[model samples]
Target: MDQHSDAYFISRVVLFNDQKAFEQLVKRYQKDVRSLLLRLTAGDHHKTDDLAQETFIRAYTYLRSFKAKARFSTWLLRIAYNIFLDSVKKEKRRKNTKLYPHQKSINPESGMDAQLDYTELMKILRPPERAAIHLAYISGMSHGDISKIMACPVGTVKSHISRGKNRIRTYLKLEL
Candidate 1:
């Protein structure tokens, strides 16, 4: 089978509104996007899938506007991150009324239902820190790419990665 580049599929979707091409793009990038959201939500598969679906929807809606300046995956991640922030804000608002049932607890062992089976590094790092580390190490994104996706400066991305690594090292007693 012949493999097509992301740009080719994107062009097909953008110029021709090709649903199959968009589906191909989704299949190509879904794992990374879903994994990013899964870790971001602390292994909430339901929330992750929901957010991933929303992300793809937004991506498809704006597919024609994609400028080809950054990789398609990075653009999708940026959308996913924005969706996550919106969800966080909505949850905060709901929590103020005591309506958000799944509010994370202070205690890791509490019935917050977090999948603590995530790596020690994932469990220890904050959301931004975890995102930076994941984008850099797992997704093989450059610092600039992460900065764009996280909507932060490159320095912030560097700090998140550094702080995340330091915390992980300290937690595991690997720091000198």
Candidate 2:
């Protein structure tokens, strides 16, 4: 592989504690990581930015654990996915405990990005379904790879995609 390839950059970071190498990796994949997080947060730009930052932090912290068997992007996205899950759990706990009475739910109009039907559609799917569908279709990952990133069985990933598609079809029909 070329010197500028992901494998090279990853090796530099892992072997030499090269912050510059990691920075290069971050610059290379920041857009993909942010895009995934933005969708997961339902167009909530603030939350997405926070989650994306956390993803990179965790990735650098655990850089040695990466086996290089999977693509670097996949590993980074897995970190992003786990961070998203943790945030969702934290938010659920906050709501369940009534920690903030004034805190409002995600406001569709408050998102900084364009409010497209795609964004609205993403809001409808459950987190796993949204992640599965996004990784499978948008990220163009195989179900096998998605299973690895999601830490779920391949069957479960398939089921999520199936259900997500059905939900979208049903939703579109109703909206029309």
Candidate 1: misplaced stretches above 4 Å? 97-116, 119-121
In model 1, how large is the Cα lDDT of residue 64?
Answer: 81
Each model's C-alpha lDDT? 0.80, 0.80
Give candidate 2 misplaced runs (Cα > 4 Å): 1-3, 97-116, 174-176
lDDT tens readout by residue for model 2, 1-176: 23499988888888999999999998989998998888777678998899999999999999999888888888898899999888776877877754222223344443325444666767767778878988888889899999988999999999999887776666554332
Clashes of each: 0, 0
Which residue pairs overlap in candidate 1's backbone? none
